[model samples]
Target chain A: MILPSAIALGREFAGARFQIAPVRGLSVQDGLVIGSVLVLIACYLLPLGAVVALSFLVPVPGIGNYWSIFQNATVHAVVGKTLWISSLTVGLTLLLGYITAYALVQAGPVARKLMLAGVLLPLWISVLVRNYAWIALLSPGGIVNSILIRWGWLDQPVSLVRNSFGVVLGMVHYMLPYAILPIYAQMARIDSTLPHLARSLGASPRQAFIRVFLPLSRPGLAAAAFLTSIMSLGFYLTPAMLGGGKTVMVAEFISIQVTETLRWDIATTLSTLLLLVTGALVWRFSHLLELATAKPKT
Target chain B: MSDFTYDTGYMQHLEQSVRRETQGKTVHRRRFLQVLSALGVSIGSLSFLPSARAQQSELVVANWGGDALPAQRDILAAEFVKRYPQIHVAFDTTGPTPGKIKALVESDNVSWDVADRNLLSALELGRQGLLEKVDESIVDINAVPSQFRTEWGVGSYFFSFVITYDAVRFGSTPPRTWKDFWDLQTFKGKRALRNNVEGVLESALLADGVAPDKLYPLNVNRGLDKVRQIKAETIFYSNTSEAQQLLRSGEVSIGSLWSTRAQGVKEDTKGRIDYHFNEGILLIAAWNVLKGAKNVKDAWRWVALSQDPYLQVALLKKLGWGPINPAANKLVPAELQAQNPGSPENIARQIVVDAEWYARNYFEVQNRYLDVLAA
Candidate 1:
């Protein structure tokens, strides 16, 4: 209605045969937009190009580096550790984030706003600060261990820092907010009436949640999982700080090669591998990204 | 910029350690002469020979940039410029050189004239033909110590991995050896060990009572099992900075730590931590000149200047490291000198890590260790 009214008003004011030509507008405006996009493309292309070039040059290629990655039990072990931590963090973040987002929508508006702010507080803090906070919070004399020991749950302070479990906990906590925000945005657009209707049709609330809302939230869940997993995959500092050099992640392993061990080909090759894996995940979920940004229900 | 008055103070400063290593070489030669004399060998049979390779002045040396050694290089460069004004000295410091050497050598992109490499790094570079044949013209023939006179290596600095315990907590009855460290039941609280396999392995082997000379061809299985035994109790630190932080917070009661790192903590803690060298991990920092060197003469000059005892002592005191120069001993305070890696008591007590054996098994053992940790 608004478009037709505006078109008629435009014809009266300008010319009798005015037409809204989006194609013309897009093409003309594309000069600036396309140019900006090309500039951004160059920015991304430069790093990717260097990485592609490096993997081939170092170790004389012919899949020697990749073969080493496969054959070398140590490198594979580190990569495996990285995969384990990243996948676990991603899974837990998605489940917890979706539940929290759903709960936020169900809560009172004022309470929802406060809780959402609390959820986001971790996200806004620097990753390093969060890592240090984890150190203090989870260390033997730190708050958590102190409480646990006081409650007779643990006889002595367990070795928490520099272990895989602490590393995953810290990573999941850091990635939680990133997961929650996207899921919340998706769930916020989900109309409450649909779930109410499901409950009215003899389905219990859990059934209504699982059958009605969960299916609708799948796209967001995919996107949140994708983002969280990718972020966790390259986590060097968290694992280094919390893993205590015991649970070496791929990023940390690669860094040790470059900085301490001085194995550039292996480091660069591993980084290239990390890039490929991350790209594969993004490509696999490209459709979910589309769904995530799809037009909100009319 | 070309004519600035450079400070050769660090290079010109080593007197203590340079003298010590030189004395050992001197003693070896003298003992050899004494043996020859005891056999009634005639000195008249030998004729004095002319030294032909005395004219080279310029050399290039490279190492990991911004560590304790570069300051010595700077001083050495200045000293070399003053001594051999005709010989131009250029130095480059880079990060660890395993991949760099491999890539640089294979591609014929070799830039380093001389490399101050870790033991393993040197072995790898030398194996790849990246290291140059070390000519001993500049080195004092009779004064060159054990590894310095090697076919492929020059002795640089010697440092230690000492057992530093919380002095405030264990003032009198501090843990002395690897056995004491392994006994966590007595040590009390948590224990920290180097996450790097070297110290962990060394401690295990030492506790096993393997002779220092035979530690090479390491018993890796034994080391890993020893590691596994303490895996639950040991807080392994890979990040160098974390060791000191762990000590400060009392998270670790005792730890096997780099001497310099342990000393760094003592500065803040006001000697709250005690470093004992009874079962120290002694290491030699070596300078290996690449075979395809850009500046061979400069590398030699850097090595010669590094051999200066004044510079050795100055760098060690300033950096909490040990010097190759025997003369460095005089510069260190008599009390602190007792703890220095170059000191007689400390040197005799510690075992020199065998680089050759480590070079052979590093790749395999590291993988195995990683698997064990993961498992």
Candidate 2:
């Protein structure tokens, strides 16, 4: 019995040594990749954890923060506006992005490259700079107004900024690039022969597009809309800049609560609600995605 | 216009979080150097890093960026370092907000040692026990006015929301008072007001014939009604930079703006733009040390150095901020004193904002103001 126990101990030590030896043999690149992943986890997950924990803990524990969402009139109005604006942004982005992506897929190589550059150019510039540029162009004395007035369109410059119209215009411009890339990626993957096959089967061009092309692009459309809507919900800068101080949104209001009012209760409550709404949206889209991709019953 | 400024308490928490991330990188670099030294590496470049770091203690000072930061660096931080060669000062040019200060203190990982914050922010945070008690042993507060000094902070500077106008457009006569600012028949042009409810409420009340001394416990309805009369023509600005840009471009003939910004624009435009402190709403800015700051002792010393009258005068000359130390005003030359908001001549004409009243009723007032604006 003693001999058997000694043997078991030796086996355990050997197993631990084997694990240690393999770790020592790890290449520099392998170590670096692992290190990078750990850094990402520490940087991203830790703050996310704090925000999540705070959402429940603030203004007294037990979902009191979440409860305030239904109680406050200002919060209610802001959330309604946020949903309306985000939906409108998603629709506009999808329509414009689909047209642009389709054009890119059908264009010649040189034209495609140029168009791609145009789509990607704004991504390179900082959002703050781009928003400022939009402000300069859209303000009453801005270039657009100057040209319109010069061409005798109106006797005076009209108010084009500091309102809902300006907010939507700025948001749509910022979201277009995000919307374009996914649809374009999916469009590039389509088989060129499918549409041709539909056409050869006695279908008209429009019918070929509707029957074959559009169905294939549904995933891309959904993805683009999902991405744009989620992004639009968190937008703070564009609306704040273009809408002036008059047009308030959820994110901006959350920020104001945290900074000006020092009301962590309200800020956390709004944030938790926003998180839930975003999560619900993503879940709904993924559910639709699963249904679409599910194999037919044999 | 910028998103955040000294007076605007927004986005400071984001800036502080970003600063904390960068501080992590500096720590890593120090650790890397330590490891190199342990390996017996004798590079001369590496030697300087440890030696320089070991000799001097670092203190982080927070202030508003854009013009105020560089002036503070030159007049205050640089001067402090010069006086105490053993100390090194770094300016974190993210404007202060009470929320960020509380976050730093509660986390017990304070990155900023000295914060340039407004009076109400300091009061609110101090009341919450988030700031270090002012080290009276190392610093003196007697020179600062009683209204501006608290147990946790001493006033750094003063500013006012002064009426500014385009000189070319209103060459003969500019809008001199809140009443003139409200009168559209005479000015006959678009005007700009801060997007803030605090200044707007005060100005409206003042314009509607509410005495400055009697403006406390504000009449919400009367102020709102006054604001509504001219709401159609007034463009609201979110920051000083935007307000300056609008005025500089002659887009708005008359506007209410911070004194420092108006002065800067006046100089930049060669006096095509101008403002006066008559009927200005005075605000006091303070510098407080964080509760858990690593360099509290040095931070107190640095704050003390800023109280020097000569340095304060130099600050007033460079930036249009009024010196909080009364001695600084005496040191300021007569010519520049005309522009100094702290000078007795100017202070008498301006009404000091009731900090205590604001600390209690700010949120209620802010929400009501937002409701008014939205309507």
Candidate 3:
């Protein structure tokens, strides 16, 4: 079954490629494409190559850096913590974003425009400002605590913006738009009357949503999860500010090694590892998405 | 009328010449190529001219920017420029973290002539051969205390990590020693500590009853154990401003903060936030010239100028950084003496940070410190 679907996906991709193939030989457009590829190689790949080379060459060369990092329990702990936080952020962002995107799809034209503006407006603000805003709202003496205490919810202000919870809160707030836009785009492409068709076929509302709408939006859910998790993996400032130095993430740990400890070998080695893992994850996710979308007609 | 006709005739002549030039396709293309090449050459040379000129007279002094930028510019750089009008001083305030200094020196593009860093950085970078030795003949090394002077760097200023607490919260029974700081049951408030291991270990050791003099070659495990004692009720602040904010906002009623930031917070809160100098970990901020600095002589001149007793006093007045020069001690008024970290009275009470021990063990110890915090 999997083989048949994979073949179908390969055939679909080949058909799409042929559909958009250029007609003629080298032209100005071809030259521009070649030039941009060369520029990308110079700008992006060369620096990445240098970083990988430095990881091996520094601290007397060989795989000593990698060997030490692998044995270092701190690196393992930091990597685990980073993965845990990224997964948490991805899950929260998807749940909230899916709800918002669904509302957007069902709302009136004017309401949709206003909701979109609300979502996209935050994206325009600087990330630093957003993180700081979360701090102001969730700190011990902040507005949330103030309100909770005034209502006699508790005697003491709860710890909010200085732990894993705060880091995830800030990250989810920042990642909401990223999650919403992709899911909303996918939802918009989905036929609105499909659920109605399912209902006419004697399906309950919940059943219709589960069987028809959820499967259709799976690609968008996967896209959102992939984007938020990838972004969360690299987050530095949110975790730094919100975690209050307790919740050490990979990016912050790498920065410490590079700047404070002067351990470039360790820093570059961790970076190279992160790059390889992310590359593998990206490849796997893309393949999974392709398989999910491919259908072998009976 | 004659001028207008001449301009029109010249325009007509130029148009006719362009038409003549374009009459031959090959010549037109060749002329275009020549103009493009000339434009590229002139623009490229123009970009190089200013950099070449700057290299002759400019000396960059890198320091952590904030309130220090304006103070250093108005005082130290201004004095240096006044003495030697031939040399101009510029400030690179991106901070001179040791890693940055190493990268700059190794890349063979050392931009900073003199960097304002800590004693540990000076010793570490000097050991790695990233810094130029201080020219004794140019800089008066004896101006500062012997402990603060090094072959590759000289004392820039003195600061300390002191216990800063909310005066309103503690009132008359304020926390004094690190022991009091660790007494969470009595203090009854959240505490803040520096995220880095530099002064944190000293504070922890002092809290654990280690004598000031015996704090060298720190007992890393013991210090971390003491830190873990209060880790549940503590917040580790990464930067000085965060430490101040933690105190000012009452997020943490007490924090171990830099003397300079503690002072700022005290004044900002109108004395509601106060710091104690007792058991303060005194650390020296130093000036080191990069190994391949473009203006070595000018850099030495800047360092020498910074050491002048009067200039150091002036900096003390503007910023609360204690003057490194002992002579500047006498110049500090009685009113500001209590505020000065290097004052005779304050110095007597505080423990000077063991720079040598940190220079060797900082990386390993800091990793452990971070581990304890994260754990």
On TM-score, the candidate that comes out on top is 3
What TM-score applies to chain A of candidate 3? 0.83
Best prediction by lDDT = 3
- TM-score, candidate 1, is 0.77
Residue-level lDDT of model 3, residues B1-375, one tens digit each, is 122123667765465344323222111122223343644633232121112223358888888888899999999888888899888787777677777777666655566789888777889889889899989889988888788978888888999999999999899999999999999989978999988999999999999999888988789999999999998788988888888888888999889998988888888999999997999999999888999888888888888888888988888888888998988898999999998999989999999998999989999999998888787
Tens digits of lDDT, candidate 1, B245-292: 888888888888888677778887999977877879887777777665
Rank candidates, TM-score, best first: 3, 2, 1
Q: What is the per-residue lDDT of model 2 for residues B222-274, given as tens digits with 9 covering 90 to 100?
A: 99899889877777777889889888866678888988888999999999989
Best by DockQ: 3
Task: Give the alpha-carbon lDDT of every model.
Answer: 0.70, 0.78, 0.83
In model 2, residue pairs whose N, Cα or C atoms come closer than 3 Å (at least 3 residues apart or on different chains), thus clashing, are B1-B242
Tens-digit lDDT track for model 3 on A1-298? 9788767666656445443234368655676688689768645664576567678777776899988999998888898899999998999999999999999999999999999999999999998998889889999999999999999997999999888899999999999998998788778878889999999999999999999999988788888888787788989999999998889999999989877898888888999998988887798786644533455233
Off by over 4 Å in 2: A1-33, A102-113, A184-217, A287-298, B1-56, B184-190, B224-235, B367-375
Candidate 1 recovers a fraction of native contacts equal to 0.37
Listed for each candidate, the true contacts retained, as a fraction, are 0.37, 0.32, 0.57
DockQ of 1: 0.15
Interface RMSD to the true structure, each candidate: 17.3, 12.9, 14.6
The TM-scores that each candidate's chain B achieves against the reference are 0.74, 0.84, 0.85
**DockQ of each model against the real complex?**
0.15, 0.19, 0.26
Query: What is candidate 3's DockQ?
Result: 0.26
